[model samples]
Target: MTTTATTAKDLFLTAMDRRFAPEVGQGDLSLALAGAELLDLLGARALTLDGDRVVPGAAAALGDVLLDEASAALVRQPPYEQVEDWLWRRGRDLAAAYRRALQADGGLSARRSGRLGLGAVRVEPVDSPARERAAARLEAAEPVLGALAAAIGIGIAADTEAGQAAVPAAAALEDEPVTTVLAAVMDAVMELEAVRRRRSIEEAAFANIWRAP
Candidate 1:
């Protein structure tokens, strides 16, 4: 595959904003961690020597991010390259599902293969090969998204509890543990930001590269 110089960064960003960040509640910490996982998936895909097989190491690594213990075990049993392909296909299907769900919820508007709407969201071509390749990345993201959402939910719950609690200062901080807990929250936020930056740079570079006469 001929990877354009900016594809990694560009796609990373798009995935972050259009998919990952919202799940993480738009925090920098969440984004950074998520970005790590996202980059790992993309990197694994980029390293495939055989298009037909899963790279075991890559699959295992990415699998750790996407699946819990039982699911991870199943992913590890397959040939690495094949597993990679499977994950990619799975992600693509899930991504399409996610998009459809979003449209249904009215979180997104219907559009074809270009930027549209007030937010300048670049809608991926529904049936494009690029989406096929992106599927694995999206699939891998499923777990991460769930984890991030859960973590934020926990955080929000804690905040609500803290607000409701009438306690001494020490007791309140101890019960909430916002300082320690916020670390994970922040990690999620940062991962999203990194992905966003990576995508923007990549998209701009891709345009410039392709436009050169």
Candidate 2:
């Protein structure tokens, strides 16, 4: 069976192939995948962001289970949540799910092993011409794919170099509705990151300030 990538989720999974580490916190990867999924839906006109809310667009299927599920979730839920909130809340083990899906599609291989004396699984891409082509396409900054790459880069800024390179390219794209939306999403995610960092620092300071007398 020839494995192919047709949606942003697929492309993101391909980019993540052999790159994700089990030691890394899942939250960053999950949010990054969520960001990629959102961009894919936006590129497909499946969803749109109005201010902070995610406005549902056409419900046409994208033939990718992850993208379809994300679309359905947006469609079924009210547009009361901001994109960042929705993403953080909904993002969970997204990278793992996509990797397993890719493995099932013959696009990747997985093996169980022990890491740091703990059980762990390692996944790598399978040899496939279609997979290579998809990876190349992702490497090249192509419209929706480029935007999705940028979103992932922004989402996991501290985790990977790919995200670092994606931000400028995504920001440099010509102005369009989708580009605008991508920029907004990036800003929202960044703001959330900032807030998280600040809260962590504040919590640490409080703990230190309340040390036993």
Candidate 3:
């Protein structure tokens, strides 16, 4: 039976929520199992029954047309059965690291770390002559934007509320540009922009990686 696209989207989001939501601890085994079940349904295994024996095959028939290398790799394995569970395990491990970072700094620095990882994985390597030129253009634009943001006194505190609330405790002169309330707001905005870009990249990579098989 074919699973609805809506169902797949729900499963994907549920998996993300369980794995990444900071308030939630590492996802439990049950959550992992549920995620696996959703993948199974979508993978559309053709199961055959012979008395008490059951066999699963035709794994690719169930998914969409865009299977990223990561997702495709899962299908090629024998226990195509455990693909979702494998994904859950990897996801949980990633989440655990982010949680630890947040717990330590109470900031969103982990989000930046996540971006670096995604960019490393998703940005295709190319030797084309135009590639270097394009990269140079992008890099050149960074300072312009960074300077603009910095000029506005954007002091990106990873955990703005937590960090800002601690700022007033300092007995030193509060006249520093970075110490102003506006600086705190700009810092929060920078952190927010970083998080938004990182999340967008991650989600896009996820979709690209898991496009139908």
Best by lDDT: 2
Task: Estimate TM-scores for all models.
Answer: 0.24, 0.64, 0.23
Q: Summarize candidate 3's per-residue lDDT along 11-67 as a digit string, tens digits.
A: 222222312122222333223322323333333443322221223445444442212
Cα RMSD for predicted model 1: 15.2
> Runs in model 2 with CA error above 4 Å?
1-4, 18-25, 75-79, 112-120, 143-169, 175-177, 184-213
Q: Candidates 2 and 3: which is better by TM-score?
A: 2
Better model by TM-score, 1 or 3? 1
**What lDDT score belongs to each candidate, Candidate 1 first?**
0.36, 0.61, 0.33
lDDT of 1 by residue, 1-213 (tens): 122222222233334344333432323322333333333443444232233342334334332323222124333444443432343334332334334433443333445433554564443324334444443333333333323333333122233443233223223333122222224334434554578899999999999999999
The best candidate by TM-score is 2
Candidate order (TM-score): 2, 1, 3
Clashing pairs in 2: 153-163
Judged by lDDT against the true structure, how good is candidate 1? 0.36
Root-mean-square deviation of candidate 2: 5.3
Question: Candidate 3 at 82: error in angstroms?
Answer: 6.4
* True-vs-predicted CA distance for residue 21, candidate 2, Å: 9.1
